[model samples]
Target: MKFQVIRLRTLLLSAALIAALFVFCLLGNRAILTVSGQLQQHGTPLILIDPGHGGEDGGTQSADGILEKDINLQLSKKIEALLHARGLQTQMTRGEDTLIYDAGCKRMREKKVSDIKNRMAMIEAAPDCIFLSIHQNYFSDTACCGTQVFYSPNNEKSALLADAIQKAVITAVQPENQRVIKPSGKEIYLLYHAQVPAVMVECGFLSNPEEAAKLTDEDYQNKIAAAIGDGVCNYLNNKQS
Candidate 1:
């Protein structure tokens, strides 16, 4: 009888130990799955900064000969620096005064097309990223001079990002600016077809003498860059929240 009691106690203890281990493993797996899900949902994304117009395509030009390409590159570089200072990863489409086109492209038209195609390929190749294209605006009236943001229609988050940038710029620099964010149309080749979140910032109108002068100023460029960087950071923080 004593032997029988001892065997039963041993069996009960073994079963208890097995049950405890099973519960522990189940909880551990749940914790692991939770962490994995969080990482997948809120992964850090690459910031792809594209400076519009380069090489032969000078884009819009100010009356005083301020090339749009130069201003775009300047602002893009400043913005990249600001973002980097805040510990964000960024990549520029063109860091120099050259076009990114395929070899063997002899004509201007071919080069422009190739350059755009290559940029699009870069956007698509990034597994997870945000596209920010910098460009200057122009109008025949010459009086239209305020920053505008256009967002991609392909991604739902694009509108939020655009709004954040618009508001940030308005609040930080152009307090009188009343321009709102707009949805990018077919005319914008990159934003129109981008599968990921994309936005084009028409920093200001080069046609307007006042705005053109400001755009060329180093201090104003820094302000614009800081505002843009803040906008991007705000968007990312809100997304994580």
Candidate 2:
């Protein structure tokens, strides 16, 4: 009986030690997560997402008739879902397919001007917001493919966001893309006028038959948007840190 009791006592002591170590590990992990999170909020300004094109503004289309506007809206919505899951604040330029223009003139130039005004209004409303405009590229040269991130020449921080996003794009999808983050001049009206940190992302080339097909696929679109969301999250968290 004495021998049995000693064995039981030893076993109990060992179990107790194991439990205590487990608790210590759990607490240490929690502390690490907390500290890392706090460090990431380096400078979390608001974020405004612009889904390029709308209503009548059906941007570049695939030969198959898929409108770039539709693709932009879908991808932006997906990004919004991911951002919301991470507890990040985001604002989209337009949620629907409706035109930014009220009506009357349907001229391309007139409508584009009105859209620019609306986009600027959104940026002005959230002066401190980081701006992101989602778009797809189309060129006569089908060879030009892959995601390209462009920053406002006027804002230095915009370049950071562009680089961060480009890194994510290359990492997630187009690993072969050689194009780097470029500056948007007068050709991109919104980037020129945006007062906040701004970047316009060309998710892929619509002119390339294969790329166009991929962009139109719902699953592929989700992947693209998710990659973008992940990049934005990393950038914002790092900025805060």
Candidate 3:
């Protein structure tokens, strides 16, 4: 009778173990399915637009004393408006002319690191957002002028987005935009590290006298914005298809 009891206990223990395993598997599967469905729902994608330089940092300047930071902010606002018009949502890193990020107290490299970390944290909070940085380029060579789009090296999808934007600029705004879309190498810190699709657009070169004049023109700015809007529209359409 003692041997019989031991065998019966062993059978009961085995059944309990099997039951626990079945419950665990059921819960795990339900969790996985729920997560997968959430991902599909949130895949609409948000665009994080970062306008380069602000306040103390004036970025590149033009002959008329126009600051690159101001131009960048203006362009970014235009882009945001254009995107909204198409029912797309956007978030700007700096909505004003002054500082948005704290550069820290110390002047050491750690301060810079802290600044970057702060920026990264802001970015990380918006995981579904892709990135677009707006800036104007300056070259010692005055002959170099035209819009150039650069994609993040870390993301292959960024290359396609850059290409579409470049095409839009060439077809809609400047028929002679021979600059071409290229991959960013060592220029932007955010683009270098982003796993999301990201690109930096250099609207025009301030060094070129004529281009500088055009960059400051209100009508010309609208044209540039329209081109970018068209580019983004095309990209989204293609993605959906």
lDDT of 1: 0.90
When sorted by TM-score, best at the front, the candidate numbers are: 1, 2, 3
Task: Compute each candidate's TM-score over C-alphas.
Answer: 0.83, 0.79, 0.78
Error of 3 at 78 (Å): 0.7
Model 3 CA deviation exceeding 4 Å by range: 1-43, 103-116
**What lDDT does the true structure give each of the candidates?**
0.90, 0.82, 0.79
Model 1: which ten-residue window has the lowest total lDDT?
32-41
What's model 3's overall lDDT? 0.79
Q: Write the per-residue lDDT of candidate 1 for residues 2-58, one digit (tens) a residue.
A: 999999999999999999999878755443222112212224577889999998899
lDDT of 3 by residue, 1-241 (tens): 9999999999999999999999878755443222112321243466778888776678898877888989899988999999878776677888998645464545545444555555566566666566788899999998999999999897778988888899999998889778888887765787788777888899998888899889888899999988987887788788778
Q: In model 1, what lDDT does residue 169 have?
A: 98
Best by lDDT: 1
Alpha-carbon deviation at 189 in model 1, angstroms: 0.5
RMSD, each candidate, Å? 9.1, 15.0, 6.3
Task: For each of the candidates, give the backbone clash count.
Answer: 0, 8, 0
- Which window of 10 residues has the lowest lDDT sum in candidate 2? 33-42
